[model samples]
Target: MSLRDRLKETRAKASDGFRGGKLMSSIFRPGSPFRKGYVDSPRNRSYVVMNNVLYHLHPVKVKRHGVRLSYTLCLGGLSFFLFIVLTITGIWLMFYFRPTELAYVDIQNLQTTIAFGSLVRNMHRWGAHLMVLVVFLHMSRVFYHGAYKAPREFNWVIGVILLLLTLLLSFTGYLLPWDQLAIWAVTVGGNMAGYVPVVGAQVKFGLFAGLEATTATLLRFYVLHVLFFPFIIVIFMAVHFWRVRKDGGISGPL
Candidate 1:
């Protein structure tokens, strides 16, 4: 065959092979359209909502009042957003943080020597504070609206756990700098835990790994701050969102 005809024949064969492939067949089944091809249409929209991991958390319909900014103030959403910001900034800060006696010097160097280090550190710090405040406000909003009744009672418990986790996350992170402020603050906090009736002393000992804030205490707090509590928060946050939908979207007028 001539070169042009030969090229056409090869192209036709390749096209046929692709059409017969199982991978392509599985992706674009005979009856189903391409996943992206479905948009705006009612069926496709429903499919998207049901199939998508994130979208599945939301109900098909939400109460008008439930979404009103004046009613909800969007505190829960803002808290989650600030959490994302803190996570991103925290990861960036981790590159420069040492979590040891040198941790304070490391932070100082991070602010002075590293590019944009001060900005990232400050964002993480402020984001953490904002998250705690927003989460507290969210709980208050839910409470005042009487959304914690009946079916939502369990979810309210989940929110309370999330609130505690938020506080714990902030507290654990506070000790990472290993400065005099961190040391004394943690020491005072540990002492307060010592006021708990039976387990107080044990809690205090576990907190500092001794009577004082030692290297072990720093490492323990670092692990909980960077790894443990964040993991638990993510899991509980998922449950919290899912329960919101399960309990009939955001609480609103009966």
Candidate 2:
């Protein structure tokens, strides 16, 4: 065949292959693993939500009043967002931190010498405080709106547990810096734990692992901060969200 005729045949084959692929893709529904389609219709949108791991957390149908910004205020969502921010920044900060006497020096170097280290540390610190505040406010909002009534009562209890977990996460992270401020603050907090009736002293002893904040205390707090408490918090948070769906989505007017 002539070179021009050969080139023409090759182009035709390529075009045919492309058309065949397109036709195969068109056969599957939108959001199929093979091809994602535009969500132009209600059914397609529902399919998208149902198919997505994250969006499936939401109910297929929502009440008109349940979505009002003024009523819900999105506090619960913002609290969860801040927790995610803390988790990211905390993981980054963990790379440079040590649970020993060098921890303070490492933090100082992280803030002054490392690139964007200070930003990440500050974000984790502030995000921890903000998560506590937002979770508390979310609980208050739920209580004031009487959203805790009926089937949601257990979810409300779950929310309270989450709030406590938020506080514990912050408290455990507080000792990681190993500075004078962290030491004294944790000392005071531990003393409060000592005020409990029977297990008070035992709790304090377990917290410090000694009479004072030593290497043992630091390591214990580090393990809890990095591993134990976060795992628990995530598990409970998942349960809390699932219960929100089971209890009929976000609370609304009666």
Highest TM-score, which number?
Answer: 2
**lDDT tens digits by residue: candidate 2, 1-254:** 99999999999787656544677466644554434334467777677677766678787678898788888899988988898888888889989998898998999999999999988988889888888889989998999999999899998888889988888889988988888888889999989999999999899999999877787888999999989999999999999999998888877785
The TM-scores of all predictions, comma-separated, are: 0.81, 0.86
lDDT per residue (tens digit) for residues 1-254 in model 1: 79999999999788667765677666653323343233466666566566555566667567888777799888988989899999999999999988787888999999999999999988988889889999999999899989999899999999999999999999989888788898888888889999999998898999888888997899899999999999999999999998887887888774
Q: After superposition, how far is residue 227 of candidate 2 from its true place, in Å?
A: 0.8
Clashes within 3 Å, all models in order: 0, 0
Instruction: Enumerate residue pairs that collide in model 1.
Output: none
Alpha-carbon shift of residue 178 in model 2 (angstroms): 1.1
* Candidate 1 deviant stretches above 4 angstroms: 1-48
> CA RMSD for every model?
6.4, 5.9
